[model samples]
Target: MNLLHANDRPGEYPASYYAATATEGERFAPLKGQVTADVCIIGGGYTGLSAALHCAQAGLSVVLLEAHRVGFGASGRNGGQVGSGQRLEQDALEKLAGKDAAHAMWDMGEEAKQLVRDLAAGMGLPFHAGVAHACYSDAEVAHARRYAEKLERDYGYDRIAPLPDGLIGSAAFKGGDLDMGAGHLHPLNFALGLAKAAAKAGATIYEQSEVHQITHGPRAIVQTGTGRVSCNHVILAGNGYLAGLDQKVAARVMPINNFIVATEPLGADAAGILARNVAVADTKFVVNYWRLSDDKRLLFGGGESYGYRFPDILKTVRKPMLEVYPQLRDVKIDYAWGGTLAITRNRMPCFVRTHPNVVSASGYSGHGVAMATLAGKLLAQTVQGQASGFDVLAALPQPRFPGGAALRWPLLAAAMTWYSMRDRLGI
Candidate 1:
């Protein structure tokens, strides 16, 4: 679990095209001594920084502490696809929450996509608008078509179009759902922009300031290595890094590791290879998602783990990438690394208050990029005396991953293996 101390350090940024393309400017120094604010946020990744941005813009005094540099967690290492929905599909949600609530959930997901696009465009950041779900098999492709059609017919939304297999012939991706409204971008760039915006809006962000302890009272005191922050309200937006902060939230949301590998530049012919420059993810429970970088390198991600330990990320990732694109057998994997995401058993995010003045939000599953951003805004709104939307999210029931904490991993692994086997057998 101590990834930094392992061999991943040398190859962490090994010729990563993203690292070369997006060199973040002016690293924020860590917190020193002690200070106070209206709100103190732990973790400088998406959730923390996004919360800082919204709260600061609302004219609240905010202080953010990061265990490491900004965008150092899953936010910086994700596949960069701006998918428009929850971790669960519409049909699955409808069954869980009923029709009315399910429709509301769908609207929120649409809003999430718009929120990402609006922020990036308004801030003048680079982004593309062609995210999709590429079907791997005929049955999966039919399911995609049915899903898209139902959305259009029942929900009055036509954002998703079914791409015929003929159009995607011989491509790594067969045909699936083509969503023009959804998009992709450089995730680290997006995260850094949010941090900058938050700072500009008067939020104090401290990097390399890890919160080791929390003391809740009239004012919450967040203790870091060299400093402590006392604030009227505290938000735990650390996601997987929230180790032992709150047992209640931690028990409900488990940290699962997922890895991605970036290939060398494939030149102008890359688009010809892909047919369209859209982000594509398959229908498997453990999905494989891939997208072309702005510079034309293929960034492929697939491997996942519920275990606390991280295996050889590069070696583990290569097998999955080659499954769809055996042509890439010769393609050199320049950069390979893993990120930890908080996944609830129900696959829905959890918004529970662990302390009177402190609230915790995690368990976005694989959908944290947008939900984390939205959660930050909602957390700030809740702290500002408006708590309706926050309550709506918090009301969602999340069952603990079956089996107690110790056995959760083995249990999830076994269940996931069964589903993966079913998928392979086309059952």
Candidate 2:
């Protein structure tokens, strides 16, 4: 089944809280005829939109194509937590890519978060600062304290503090680090703002224009259902829904569905769930993350599925939300939705140049909010022959799944089953 249309309708956003409260503007028309540009971007999420804006600002003629509405995918449906570092911790990154490379990667991560903060401030969106790491055990708490100190001493960054009572109203958690620099926002509004900025910067955007094939050459021809865009460069930024685009990138990036639920306005009860206006991410292999919405509702993301079809989202997400806030047992679910996010075996983004003129970035794992935005800026620079940052990200390890794209789902499903069980057993 095609993930593009498997769960959500064509040319429309999912029935998500983000969609209901989306910033109202710019419904881009679909590609109707042949067009030519300096760059053709396939995907309209954060990566593609950011790339379009940056490329257009750099005076490159750009055309961005989206299968459905812009930000209709994970960009809009995400937990909205702007994390501070890469998917892996600094020590892990240092091990994966030498010390120098890891430091550079950390710098890039900082740049990414700042870029998002600046963009949100410019768009007049309120960015609530603080994201706490919710640890469940003494060992995990000790590790988090050490990591925070490492960030301060080794990295020379110090916005994180250790919270003894964790950040949420959950007895399951002991305590963890709270990074005041990392924060949350309305993800859909941010994406819509990016689309507006890209349009203002002269990037041609098309909705309901799914790219079916790319006839690669010096001047690549990216064909959609209705029209085609012939450009000198191609950027595959589809993320989870980027199946059949490039077999090479697809091998390392496997798509999976994650669910979230928004509860009815809790009024005074909201403060009890999250004492501070910040986001909390747990230490589970299948993470349980949550934060209070602007209207005093709890927006919780959790649970996992093994296939193209979404499981009962309200049921899947509420179970975990209640696990954290058992006081919310009788709370009514206002909205529940599922979005596809791609992951790699090592949980790092897969950045690769499939061809000399074509670059693709995806498999952000769960760190897409910051990294995906940065990937777009780097992609624009690479397209313009200034590829220092892009080269660094590309130099990082990009491992292909054992069976590439074909059998990865089944294999990963089996592995996730084992991990989820371990989580249940608290092992």
Question: How accurate locally, in lDDT, is each candidate?
Answer: 0.79, 0.91
To one decimal, what is the Cα RMSD in angstroms of model 2 from the true structure?
1.0
The residue pairs in collision within model 2 are: none
Model 1 spans with C-alpha error above 4 angstroms:
1-16, 164-174
Candidate 2 C-alpha lDDT tens digits along 312-352: 88888888777778888988998999999999878988889
lDDT of 1 by residue, 138-226 (tens): 87789888988888898887888877454432455557878887788888888888888899899998887878899999998999889
In candidate 2 the C-alpha lDDT for residue 29 amounts to 96
Model 2 spans > 4 angstroms off: 164-167
The C-alpha TM-scores of every prediction are 0.93, 0.99
